[model samples]
Target chain A: MQAFDHHTPQTLPEALALLAQHDGTARVIAGGTDLMLYMKSGKAEPETIVNIKKLQPLQGISATNAGDLRLGALVTLRELTRSPLVLESYPSVAHAAGFMASEQIRSFATVGGNLCNASPSADLAPPLIARSASAHIVSADGEREIPLEDFFRGPGESALHAGELLQAINIPPPKGNAVYIKHAPRAFMDIAVVGVAARLELAAGRCRTASILLGAVAPTPLRARQAEAALAGQSLTDDIIANAARIASEECAPIDDIRGSAWYRRRMVGVLTRRALTALSNAQPLHAR
Target chain B: MAKILVSLSVNGDPHELYLDTRRTLLDVLRDELGLLGTHRGCDAGDCGACTVHVDGLPMTSCLLLAADYHGAQITTVEGVLDDGKPNSLQQALVEKGGIQCGFCTPGFVMNGLALLSEKPRPTEAETRAWLSGNLCRCTGYVKIVDAVMTAARQSP
Candidate 1:
C-alpha cells in the first residue's frame, strides 16, 4: 500500500472540507474494504484519506416520517442483515446484504461504500433500484437527493462530486413484493455472474407496476424498462413471465469476464428473471436460498 | 508519509506506538506487538487468515488501519486463551483433528469463537455459513465443522 495522510474527521463538514482541500485527490473511507484493495493494487493512490467513521450523522438505520427506510452511509452490511425493520419491510434488501462477500467482509463493509464504489455487480444496487430508492448526498455546500438509479455513472464511478459525501439511502415503504436472485457459482464469497431483482405490485390478479433490474450485465445496474412495460397491467401468466424474461435478457449489455462469459450471463439473466417472477407470482416466502 | 501515534487495546493490553499511516492492524499485531498468532494470508480481505475481533466482531485485520481504530478493543487469536491454555474451541479443534497445515487455524478459531459466543449451539448450516469467510484448503472443512459443533456442545 502507498503511504498517505490519514484524516479522521469528527464531523461531515470537516470530512467534506478535507476532500475539498485535497482537490479531488482525497478519498473518504468508512470500512476501507474496497478502498484498501484498490490502494494495495495501485489502482487508487489518494494523497489524503478522509476517515468518516467518526461522523455521527453517517450512522444508524431509521425510518423517515413518510415510512421510508433510511439507511445511513456508515451502516454496515451486518447491521442491515440483522435489522428487524429491514428484514420485515425490505426482505429483498436484507437478502442482498447477507448474500454479499463473507461474514468478515460484511462485518465492516458499509452500504454507502457499496453504492459509492459503483460496482455493476453490487448486491445492494439492483434491489434498491427495484424498490425505487434515492440517495441523499451531503457536502459543504449542502445536501441533495437523487434517484438511486441515477447514482451510478459507470463502473467504479458515481454521481458524487469530488467533495460530496453520501449521507444515506432512502427507500419508500414497500408497495410490492421484490425478489433478488444472484447467479454465482459459490453461495458465499463470490461475485455474481448475473443478478436480477424483480418488484411487482399486483392488484386483482393483474400487475399494476413492475420494476425489473439487472446487475453485472451492464456498466451500471440496468433497469429493464421494456420488460417492466411488458408486465404492466397484464396477468403474470407463465407465458407472459417467460416473454418478459426473454425481453430482459436481450436488453442488457454484458461482457466476457473471468467469472463468466457474456453468453452465459445473458442466459442466466433470463433464467433468474423467470424464477424471480415465478416466485413473486406464487407469493412464495421472501427468503430464497 | 509521516508516522502517527496510535493507541489501542489488544488482548486486554493497552499500548501506544508510532506507526506509519500505511501499516495495517495485521502489521501492528504481527510486527509491532509481536503477536504472531494472527497469520497474514491474503493481504486482501478475501482470506480471513488475519481475522480478529474488533470491538467484539470478527474483521479482517489486514484491511483495517491501526490508526483508524485508535480506541478499539481488539481480541486476537492469542487473546482467547484461558490462563495461557487453549480454550474449548481450540481444544475441540485439536481433538477433532481440524488442523492440517495450521496456517488458517488462528483465523478459524477467532471467527468460530465469536460465532460460538453469539450462538452457543449453532446448527450445521449456520456453522458453515459463519465460517465461510475463513478458507482451509486442507481437511476439506468436514473436521472443522465437526470441531465447531463439538465446541458448541461443550461450551457452558
Candidate 2:
C-alpha cells in the first residue's frame, strides 16, 4: 500500500474539516475492508487517510420520525444482521447483510462503505434500493439527502462530493413484503453473478405497488421499472410473475465478466427475479432456507 | 510514514505499540506482537485464516487497521486453550480427524470456539454458516464440520 498521512478524528466535524482541507487528496476510512484492498491493488492512492471509526455520531441503528429506518454510516454489516428492527421490519435487508462476504468481513464492512464503494455487485444496494432508501450526506458546507436510486453514478462511483461524508442511510418502512436473492456460483465468499430484490405491497390479493431492483447486471443497481409496472395493481399469478421476470431480464445490460457471462447473468436475473417476487408475494423470507 | 499509538488488550495482556496507520490488525499481531498463530492466507478479506476475536466477535484481522481498534480486546488462536489444555473444539478436531495440513487449523479452531461460545449447541446449518468465512482447502470440510458438531454436543 502507498504511504499516507493518517488522522484519527474524534468528531465528525473535525473529520469533515480534514476532508475539506485536503479535498481530493484525502480519503475517509471507516472499516477499511474495501478501501485497504483498493489501496493494495493500486486502484486508490490518497495522500491522507482520515480515520472516522471513532466518530461517535456515525454509529448505531434507529427509527426516524417518518417511520423510516436510519442506519449509521459506520454500522457494520454484522450489526445490521443482528438488529431486531432490521430482522423484524426489513428482513430482506437483514438477509442481504447476512449473506455478505463472510462473518469476519461483515464485522468490519460498514453499510456506508458498502454503498459508497458503488459496485454493481454490492450486496446491500439492491435491497436498500428496493426499499426506496435515501442517503444522508454531510459536507463542510452543509448536509443533503439523496435517494438511493440517484446515488450511484456508475460502478465504483457515487454522487458524493469530494469532501462529503455519508452520514447514514434512511430506508422508508416498507409498505409491503421485500426479499433479496443472489445467485453466486458458490454460496459463500463469492460475488453475486445476478442479484434481485423485490418489494411487493399487496392488498385484497392484488399487488398495490412493487419495486424490483437488479444488481451485478448493470453499471449501477437498477430498478426494473417495466417489471415493477407489470406487477403493480395486478395479482401475481404464475404467468404474470414469469412475464415480469422476463421484462427484468430485458432491462438489465449485463456484460461478460470473470464471475459470469452476460448471457448467464441475464438468465439468472430472470430466474432470481421470479423467485424473489414469488417469495415476496407469499411474504416469505428469502434466506429462511 | 505516519504511525499511531494503539493500546489494545491481547490474550488477556494489555500492550501498547506505535505502528504505521495503515498496518492491519493481522500485521500488527504477527509482525509487531509476534502472534504468528493467526495465519495470513489471503491478504484480502475473502479468506478467514486471519480470523481473531475482537470484543468477543470473530473478525478478519486483515481487513481492519490496528489504529481503528483502540482499547479493543483481541483474542487469537493462541488464547483458545487454557493452562496448556486444548479447548473442547481443539480436542474435538483431533479426535474427529479434522486436522489435515494444519495450516487452516488455527482459524477453524478459533471460528469454532467463537460459534460454540455464542451457540452452545449449533445446528448443522448454523455450523456451516458460521464456518463459511473460514475456507479449508484440505479435508473437504467434512471432518471440520463434524468436529464442530461434536464439540458443540460436548459443550456444557
Candidate 3:
C-alpha cells in the first residue's frame, strides 16, 4: 500500500466535496477489501482515500412503504445474507450474497463495492440486473438514478462520472420468480466460472415474461437478450428450457483463464441457466412459499 | 509520506497513534504495538492468518488500513484471553490435537471465537463454513473440526 492522505467524511456533501477536491486521483472506500488489493498491485494510486463509512446517507437496510427495497451503498454483504427482510422478500439475492466470498470477506465487503468494482465474476450483478434494480448516484450538483442493468461499463469500471458516488441501489418487489446459481471450483471463497440469473412470470404453464442475465462470461455481466426473448411467452417445458439454454450458451463470449476455459464457461452458462429455471419451476420462491 | 491520526481500541485498551495511511492494522499490531500473537502469513486477504475481530466481526487484519479503523474496536489473538487463562476454544484445540506447528492456531482460535459468539452451539456444517477463511498446513482439518466441536460442547 502506498502512503496517502485519508479523509473520513461524515456527510454526503462532505464526501462529495472530498471527491471533487481529489478529482480522479481519489478513490472512495466503503469496506476497503478489494481496494487494498488493487492498491498493493499498483493498479490504483489514489492521492486521497475517502472513507464514507461514517456518512448517514449510506448506512441502512430499509424498505419503503410502497414496497421498494433501498439498500445503502455501505450496507455489508453479510447483513444482506442474514437480513430477514431480504430472505423473506428476495431469497435469490440473499443466496447470492452467501455464494460470494468467505464469511470474513463478506463481513466487510459492501454491495455498492461489489457493483462499483465491476468484476465480471461479481455475484450480485446478475441478480440485481435480473430484478431491474436502479442505482442512485450522488454528486456535488445533485442526485441521479440509473438502472442497475446499465451500471457497469467494463471490467473494473463503472458508469460513475467524476466526483459522483453510488448512494444506494433501489429494487422493487418481485412480480415473478427469480433464481441465481453460481458455478465455482470450490464451495466457498471462489470466483464463479459461470453465474446465471433468471426471472420468469408463469401463467397457465406458459412463461409470460422473462429476464435472463449471465455473469463471468463477458467483459460485463450481460443480459442474454435473445435467450430471454426465446423464453418469453414460451411454455417452460423441457424442450423450451433446453432451447433457451442453447441460445444462452451461444450468446455469451467468455475468455479462457485459470478458473476455466472459454468453451467450458460457455457450456456451463447453458447448464446453469437450465438449472436455475428448473429450480424456479420445481419449487416456489421463498417469498411465495 | 502522509501521516494520519488513528484511535483504536485493542483488547479494550485505547491507543492513539500517528501512522501512515499505507500501514495496515496487522503491521500496526506486530511492529508498533509489539503484539506478536497475530501472524502475517499472506498479506493478501486469502490466507487469513491475520484474522482479527473488528466490531465483533472477524476480518483479515491485513486488508484493513489503520487510518480507516478510526474509533474501531479491535480484538487481536492476544486479546481473547479470559482472566489470564486460555479460552474454551484454545483449550479444546490443545486437548484435541488441533495444533502441530502452531503457526495457524491463533487464526483458528480467533475464527472459532467468532463462530461461538454467534451460536454457542452450531452444527458441524456451520462450524466448517465459518472457519473456511483460515488455512492450516500442519494438521489437516480433522482435529481442528474436533476441537471446534469440543469447544461448542464445553460452552453450550
Candidate 4:
C-alpha cells in the first residue's frame, strides 16, 4: 500500500473527528481486504486511513426490543454466519455470508465494508435488500438512516458522504421465508455471476408479499419491483414463478464480464430466481421450519 | 514519515517495534520478525498463503496493517507446532502425500489447524470447503483433503 498515516481510533467520535479533519483525503479502513488492494494498485491513494476496528459500538450483533436484528457495522462475515439470531431468523443472510470469499476472508471482512465498497456482486447486498434492511449512518454532525437499496449509487460508489460512516444495518423482523442464491463457477472464493434473493410472505395459500433482489447484473443490487409485483397477491404456481423469473431476468442491465457473459447472467438470473421462489414455496411455514 | 509503535504477541512471544505504518502484518511477520513460515503469495488476499490466526480466527494477514493489530494474539503456522514437533495435521499431510511443491504448506497448516480446532470431526466435504481458500497450485487437493480428514480421525 501507499504511505499513509494510519489512525486507530478507539471511539466512533474520535474516528469521525479524524475523518472530518482529513477533509476528503482520508478513507476509513474496515476489513481492508479491498481497500489494501486498491491502495496497492494506486486505484485509491488516500492520505490517511482511519481504522475504526476498535469502535465498540460498531461491533455487536443483537436483536432490538421489537425483535428486529441489529447488526453492527464491524461485525465480520464469519460472525454474521455464526450468529444464532442471523442463522435462525435470517437464514438467507447467513447463507449469503457463508457463500462469500472464504473462511479466511470471512473472518475479518465486515458487512459494512462490503456494502461501502459497493461491489455489484457483494453477496450480502441481495439478501439484506430482500429483507428490507436499512443502513444506519453516523457522522460528526449527527446520524441518519436510509433504506439499504438506496445506499448504492453504482459500482464502488455509495450514498455515504466524505465524512459520514455506516454505523450499523437494521433488519426488521422477517415476515416470510427467504433464500439467497449466488451463481459462481466455484462454491467459494469466486465472485457471483448472478445473485438472487427472494422472500415471500404467504397467507391462505396466496402470496401476501414478495421481495426479490438481484446482484452482479446491475450497477447496484437491484430490487426486481416488476417481478415482485407479479408475485404479490398471486398463488406461487409453476407458471407464475416462471413468469416472475423471466421478468426479473429482463429487469437487470448486466454487462459482459470475466465471470460470465451478459446473456449467461440474464439466463442464470431467471433460473436462480425460479429456483429460489420454488424452494421458498415448498418450504414449511416460517415459524415451523 | 514517523514509524508507529506496534505491540503484539506472536507464536507465544511478545514483540514491540516501531515500524512503518504501511507495512502489513504479513510483511512484519516475514521481514521484521523473521517468521518466514507465513509466506506471501498474492498479497491481494486472493491466495491464502499468508493465512494466520488473529484473535483465534484464521484471517489473511497480507491485508492486515501491522499497526492496526496492536495487542492482538497472532498465530502463524510455526505457532501451531506441538512443542517444535509436527502437529497431527502436519504429520497427516506428510504421510498422506499432501506435499508436492510445499509452497502452500504453511497456509494449509494454519487453515487446517483452525478447522480441527473448531470441528474435531469434519466430513470430507466439510474439510474440502474449509481449505478452499488456501490453493495448492499443484492441484494436489485430494491428498490435502485426505490429510485433514485423517488428522481429524486420528485425533482422540
Q: Which has the greatest lDDT? A: 1
Model 1 Cα lDDT, one tens digit per residue, B57-95? 999999998889988999999889888899988999999
What is candidate 2's DockQ?
A: 0.74
Comparison by lDDT, 3 against 4, better one: 4
Tens-digit lDDT track of model 1 for A70-113: 99999999999999989988999999999898899999999999
Clashing pairs in 4: none
* TM-score, every prediction: 0.99, 0.97, 0.98, 0.98
Using TM-score as the measure, name the better of candidate 1 and candidate 3: 1
The digit string of per-residue lDDT tens for model 4 on A1-289 reads 5688888998989999988888779999989889988988999988788889999999999999977899999999999888988988998889889879989999999999999999999899998998999999998999999999999999999999989999999999998999888888899999999999899999998999999999999999999999999999999899999999999999989999888999999999999999999988987422221
Which runs of model 1 end up more than 4 angstroms from their true locations? Answer: A286-289
Over 4 Å off in model 2, which ranges? none
Per-model interface RMSD values are 1.0, 1.2, 1.0, 1.1
Model 1 pairs whose backbones collide: none
Q: What C-alpha lDDT, on a 0 to 100 scale, does residue A122 get in candidate 3?
A: 91
Error of 2 at A219 (Å): 0.4
**What local lDDT score does residue B16 receive in model 1, on the 0 to 100 scale?**
94
- A151: Cα error in model 2, Å: 0.6
Candidate 4: docking tier: medium
Rank all candidate structures by their lDDT, best first, as comma-separated numbers: 1, 4, 2, 3
* Residue A232, candidate 2: C-alpha displacement in angstroms: 2.0
